[model samples]
Target: MNQYPLWKNLLILGVVLFGILFALPNVFSQDPSIEVSAARGHEVTEATPDEVRAVLQNVGVPFKAVEPLAEDKVLVRFPSSGDQLRGQEAIEAHLADRYNSALTLVADLPGWLRAIDAQPMYLGLDLRGGIQVLIDVDMEAALEQGLERYTGDIRSLLRQEKIRYLTVMNDANRVTVKFGDAETLDKGRKLIDREFRELEFETASDGKNFDLYARLAPAEEEQLRDFALQQNITTLRNRVNALGVAEPIVQRQGERRIVVQLPGAQDPARLKEILGATATLEFRLVDTEGSVQDAVEGRVPVSSRLYYDREGRPVLLKRSVIVTGDQITNATSGFDQNSGTPAVFVNLDSRGARRMREVTTENVGKPMAVVFIENRTVTEMVDGEPVKRQVRTEEVISVANIREPFGRRFQTSGLDSSEEAHNLALFLRAGALAAPIQIVEERTIGPSLGQENIDQGVKSVVYGLAAVLIFMGLYYRIFGLVADLVLLTNLVLIVAILSLLQATLTLPGIAGIVLTMGMAVDANVLIFERIREELRNGSSPQASINAGYGKALSTIVDANITTLIAAVILFSFGTGPVKGFAVTLSVGIFTSMFTAILGSRAVVNLIYGGRRLSKLAI
Candidate 1:
């Protein structure tokens, strides 16, 4: 009755082998290293590694090897994480600004194993040290910006409709449009009412001028704030990805707060800079007729602004912007074809293109300058407390005559080096933050602490598994040994599946694995108990074996399916470590059922199937 089919035996054998193969990568240790990638217009040649090696030697930082990698990259391997960090500092200090260096952990797996594309499971923040940041979004500033846009839109709308307005200005999150006549104000209000239904409007008369005041509705305000938070999360994700960090977490926390976690991030200062700075671009007329000396002496023209280029030379630029970074649809960094110098190719959206076309058509021979603007917070310690102050910088990055009037597509050159071009491309490619953000809380987890967590988690899993194996072997004898053996396979299958799925393993996830170890054999215990009951009822050994699996199958399926549903719910609704726990438990539930039911049965069948016995191992 318990005779096995050929297909069943083959299937079980295949699963064991497959599980072993994919799970093999976890056994190999990862080497601490630094990856150095060249910026635009640079290459990592054969001598690149030697130069880095020489720099390390001069700095007295020991290194195992300096090897070249694919894609204009080089890897500097270190025997210790300490040495890796020291080497990173030394290399970054010695190398030119064009090279981007990132600390990484690379596995030294065998070529054959890697040939099959097998990889280890990702470790979460608890297992890999990194940084976690809590940021507060500036919703008021976002609202003010929205109002500013509304003011501009109102002015443009009036101009398009040939309705004249005295002034359209945004003040304290409200846009007020003043008109010289009530007829024009009525027309503007009707136009605004039709176009911007989301704004709450009010009207009043001031002396001879008529005014229309507007602000966002409550629902619209909430939605705008939510959108800013979401956009910042996406932008932060892109920036972290550009930094080459692995498995970084950027998620919305509360209403106005965002939680950012970067796993395996070593350079927190660089990370802070990337996360905090709001870098953008603007294209404006160079004011060829305006005097730079007059602007420098604080006699700046009403239509112009004084700014310095990358070389710190004063330049006069029109205050009216033709285009901004927000309109850029795509940007890429490379060498310009004609000059062979570093440049950023830019493409604009329809609105920006229209603006660009109008500006270039009107001022064909005039020079247009590309201004790089950055807003950041500088922290200073005063009275033993840190105080943050906002700072804004605008520098002209490039300037060239509007040659033949181009719209939508253009390239900006004049960067000092390829690094600047690459960074500009990175900023443009990653959309700008919708509003300013304040880093309210920050914490860095060291790799050593992560190692301690891993060590403790593994030790607990080992002890729990060993205890279960010992109990089953002593109690159930032959069947117990089979259960114990299959239980071990169940663990392997779980790891293999987790590795195959590339799920992140966390400390709580390890707890889930331990829970699975105890629960994996529940079905086996049920079947074995049922078999003993059948034997007491005077059934034949073969008949009892079949009846045990057959009678317990319904209970097993019912129990496991219910647990699976709960795990799915947890996975869907949970976040962070809770999600990690759910993932491991979910995978373990399936593998546990496979090993306990099919795997144990196959072993038992191989030993005793199609045999006539007076007594059973039980």
Candidate 2:
């Protein structure tokens, strides 16, 4: 029985410790890989897998493969190369393709992992030197978008019904449609209610005059706001993920704010260029017959101006905007056979198609333009190049008069190259942010800072372990050495389990391990002290050892139970790094209890078995 327990304890400890040591290489080893993290104005967040793929695709970089980690992160590895940037560019382009956003280049691991390489644990931004971006999604912007949508729907409905109105304007966040009679107003209100279930209306009548105000209900407003926030977070995640940044933290902070953390971002300027821009595409109708001539001749239409040279770019005349970018569902890059150059293929929804048909039919054989806006401003081409536009209809979908639903997949052909088309597709897919977001807070940690944290964390663990070992050995003597052996064994088992789980080690987690190391000796101390007490009462050595373990068992269970309860509470309430610490601590406590109680008992039994002891050391 003694041989069995001793062998069992040794076998368990050896298997766990050896398992961790063996698996370490696979988890942390750098196999010609690229990792990305973002930095914006001193804020850093790790890039998601999608973000990393985007960067790689955008830059035409090649990767062997890409693997995803939980929490919007990725692992990217490239073939060994002399040009690291080239590999990075490939990864960046992949990220952009997948996420449609730029990537912030993170750390490039050494060709191999050495003995001193960081433990396979989550390195928090505070310890890893990264970026933190706190974005406040603009509520006003989301409201404006919703309002615009409502207005567009109203106009289309009126046009379809052929109801003429004198003034149709959206002012003060309310769509004011003045019809010739109250009957028309009543009809319009009912039509709106039928289409938009989320809309709320208040009607006012003064004699024959009438006005209707349409708005969102309180519950609907809250829902809309939440949707807007989620969209913002999603978009941000997409963009950051595209950048090939590693381990980015993108999360909704409050009602209308998001927090992004990039663990390794080198270029802040590039991050700003990618994150701050709002890419929007619109199709405006052209009044080809009389636009430039009449406007220059002082015949400007109401609410429309003839810009001879608008935004200091071109001399193009347009009458009224037919459709906003919101109607566009998808855009892709393709080629026009006639010109043999690059082009973008664009797709619209049913409403957009109908509007396109009407506008194109009305202005056949005329010049039209597709306006691309970034951040509410039109993006101007540096060179004045001829850009052709096409308007598609139902005929394009169901050719030969066959009835077919329009395919969701549409192309935006006629771009210069695959890159341009890809970029456009990315932009369209990203769509308009449900709201505008402003960075309210940002913090950037440097690589040096991360290194410093590592240094301090290691120092604490070393000192803490040393102090514990010294105190245990001096107080418990021979039994203390056995306990110390168990304590070291406890660390090995904890790390093995952590590695097996692929858990990230944060600074607090290091403290947790240190605490576990200190407490590992508690059970052994209990048993050894009890044995000494028994020896003073003239008990035999074997009897003393048995008595000591039996007496200590109840105390160990009570103490460990309280510790386990606290660990569970910490884990439940904590987030990110704190949670990691709690997990490691809890795991450590359980392992320590097993090794300390069972392991120490096995060791004492081996020492005292089948032997008559002359004296028992106290």
Candidate 3:
């Protein structure tokens, strides 16, 4: 009654072999290596390896091998961490102008295994060292910008409604419109109140000038701040993706803070540079009418502004901007067709396009400058003490004569390097933050802690498995041995499944695997107990073997189904580590059920099925 078909036996054998093959990759260890990548406008040629070798030799740092990697990168493997660190430092210091180097871990898997795509599971942030950045969003700036927008809107509204206003300006987080008389003030107040529902209007008159003030409601301000926070979070996510970071955690921390955790990130300086950058571009007409020396002497024309280029050359540009980065719909980096110089191609929205067309049509053959503006913090010595200062620097990156009236598209050349072009394009494509953000705190996780976590997690699984195996082997003799064997297969199946899916295993995921070991054998215990009961009630060996599996099927299914539901729920609602735990737990449930019931039954049938035995070894 228990004899299995040939197809069933082959299927079982195939699965066992498949599990072993895919799970073999985890046995390989990683080597400490230095990754070298070319800095902007540089290429990693075959000579890169020789240059790295020579640098290491000169610095007295030992390296096992040096090889070129994909995407214009190089990898230098070292036998020890000391060698890796020393080599990385030497390479970075020596080649800082042309290349960037960092210490990273390279897996030592064989070529054949990699060829077949047999890969190990990715570890999460808790198990792999990464960087955590806490950024403070400037909510007050967002509110001020909102008020400025209201000022512009009110100016347009007054002109359209023929209600002449003397002045409209934003100050103290409020838009104040100055009117000549009470009649004009009353008309503007009614117009603003009818159109802008989110603003509260108040009026004051100092004998002659009538001043009308409008401020955002408290609820509206709160919503605006929340929107800024969310927008920054999305922007950070896009920037992280551009950096090629894997499995990043970007979430809102508080009312005006964002938390970004990038797993497996090694370059802290680059991360800081990109995430803290508030770079934008503005197009303005070169002010040929304004004298440069007069502008430098602080007698500048009211319609012109002074800025410096990358080479420290001063340029005069019109104060009115034709278009800004906010209007850019897309930006990409490439080489110019004719000049072969690095360039950034830009696309603008409809509104910006219309403005560009109007201005270029009017000022054809005139020079237009692309101005790059960035806000940053600098430390300078003041009275023999270092003081931090917030600075806004503007520079002219490109200036070209407009040949024809064009709209919606343009290209900017004259970048210092291809790297700068790429970074500028990346920032523009990712979209600017709603308001400014400052990195208030940063922490870099070391690989040593990640190693400790991995060691402890492995030990937990090993120790748990050993204790269960010993107990099962001693409790029920022959059947206990069968359960122990299937438990091992179940473990292999779990590893294989996780590897195949390439899931990230966190510290909590390790805990789930350990807990699953105990749960894995619970089904075997139930089946063994049912078999023992059948034997005591006078059933023969074959009959009890069949009866044990058949009757316990319902109980095992019901139990696993309930636990699986819980895991699914956790996976749906949880984030980060909780999600990792749920994934491993859910995978374990399926693998354990397969090995406990179908696998163990197949083995039992081979040993005791279709046999004549008067007694059982239980």
Candidate 4:
């Protein structure tokens, strides 16, 4: 009556084995290593390992292994962190122009385990040493840029329609266009009202000149702000992915700020470079009529601007942009078919493709320049004082003749090397941020401190488990041992599920596990005490055991269900560490219920189910 069926026993055994297989990966430790990747056009071939070995040999640094990785990367493992750092520096210095090296900790799991893609659970930034940054988006600047674009579009529209205007000016919040007479002003106002539904136009006149002012509607402004924030978040996420950071966090904080946490990121400076710089692309017509020498001498043309190339050669380009980086949907680096030179293939969105077609069709045989613009901050000495200055650099990366009208896809050549092409493609793929962001706060957690946290957390779990195990083994004797075994299994199951789900673990999560250990025994205690009560009422051993579990099932379910509800609520509403705690608690509740009721009962039935006993152990 108390024994489980053969199928149920097999099913329980299968689950236990499944949990063990997934939980086994955590036993393997990570190794200190240096990851070597091609900077741009370079490739890490089989010979790359030999080259790295030579470099490390020359530097007198010993390495455990030099292995080739996918995607033109290499991994150089060392026995210690000191050797890892030394080897990384030596490699970087020797191949500064060709390769980029970063120190990292890679999992040293067996090939067979990795074949199934088994991995340990990801740890949060607090548990894994890494960098944390808080970036503040410049919403005011974004609004201003949007208004400026609208002002330019309005001017172009009026000119295209042959509507004459005396002057056009854009202030912080409004664009004003002055016409010579009321008739022209009325015609312009009607045209704007018909074409631009997002703008609200106001008309004023002082008898001589008529003026029409256009301002973005309130709803439109809010939408623009929201779009800007969302776009910046997406751009940052893309950049982080390109960096190949594992388990990075790029999330919005409040309305205009973003919090980025990069766990296991080795080089914080490189991360800052990737996150801080705003790189963008613009296609503009090369102004053949304007002399670069004239513009360089400060006599720039009204309709053209001068920019330098990567080699410091100046070229004149038109002020009007044909298309911006935002229109690019995809980009990749490859070789030109005929010349075999490094080139970037770009694919634009539908709107951008149409615009490109129109522009190229009108200006066939003319040269168009692909301009690379970067906005960065640097510290410069001014009057013997170090001052932070914002610098803007614009360079023409490619200038090619428009042989035929094309859209959607095109190739840009003239890149100096494959590395340049690769870097350009990476930048284009990441896209440009909609608004500028400044890092307002920064923090770095050292690995030693992170290790300390892990040590303490592990100690807490060990101590808590030991205390509970001893208490259970002494209090109820044999049945208590059964509960302890189930409790241990419950912990293993929780970890296996976490690893399978790839949930990040934090300190509070460890606390949740400890709390779960205590609660896991509660259900067993309820059942045991119920059995004792039945035995006191003169029931037989097997009958008392059956009565105990049957009577206690409803109460255990009710108690656990209520706690599970609270855990779910916490996970839904809480953020960061709180959510981590809630997740562990919620997962623990389910596993504990399974092990306590079904697992404990299965073992008990095996031990005492069919045997006729005069008295119980309790």
| Candidate topping TM-score | 3
Cα error of candidate 4 at position 242, Å: 8.2
Judge candidate 1 against the unseen true structure and give its global Cα lDDT, from 0 to 1: 0.82
Count backbone clashes in candidate 1: 0
Q: How does model 3 score by TM-score?
A: 0.80
Ranking by TM-score: 3, 1, 4, 2
lDDT of each: 0.82, 0.61, 0.83, 0.83
TM-score of 1: 0.77
Worst 10 residues of 1 by lDDT: 379-388
**Model 3, stretches more than 4 Å misplaced?**
40-47, 159-162, 165-182, 200-222, 241-246, 252-256, 265-431
TM-score of each: 0.77, 0.58, 0.80, 0.76
Clash count list over all predictions:
0, 73, 0, 3
Output the better candidate (2/4) by lDDT: 4
Candidate 1 regions with alpha-carbon error over 4 angstroms: 37-48, 55-61, 88-102, 134-144, 166-227, 237-247, 252-257, 264-432, 437-444
Please give, for residues 131-174, the per-residue lDDT of candidate 3 as tens digits: 78788888988887667556756766787788998888776889
**1 or 3, greater by lDDT:** 3
List model 2 lDDT by residue over 325-426, tens digit each: 555676666676666666666677777787767766655656555555444211122333222121211101100111232233333332335644555556
Better TM-score candidate (1, 3): 3
Model 2, position 68, has a per-residue lDDT of: 58
Q: For residues 1-618, could you state the per-residue lDDT of candidate 1 as single tens digits?
A: 687789989999999999999998988987777777653346677888888999899989998888887656788888888898788767666664445566666677899998998988877778866678788898988887677667666766777788888777776679888888888788889998999999999999866869899989999999889888988888888888888765577898888999998765544445765765667788989988888998999999765789999778999997666787767888889999998999999999999898788779888988999998877655544554444556777899888898777889988888767866787788888876777787778665545557888899989989998888888988888999999999989999999999888777888899989988877888889999999999999999999999998899899989889988988998898867787898899999999999988999999998889999777776
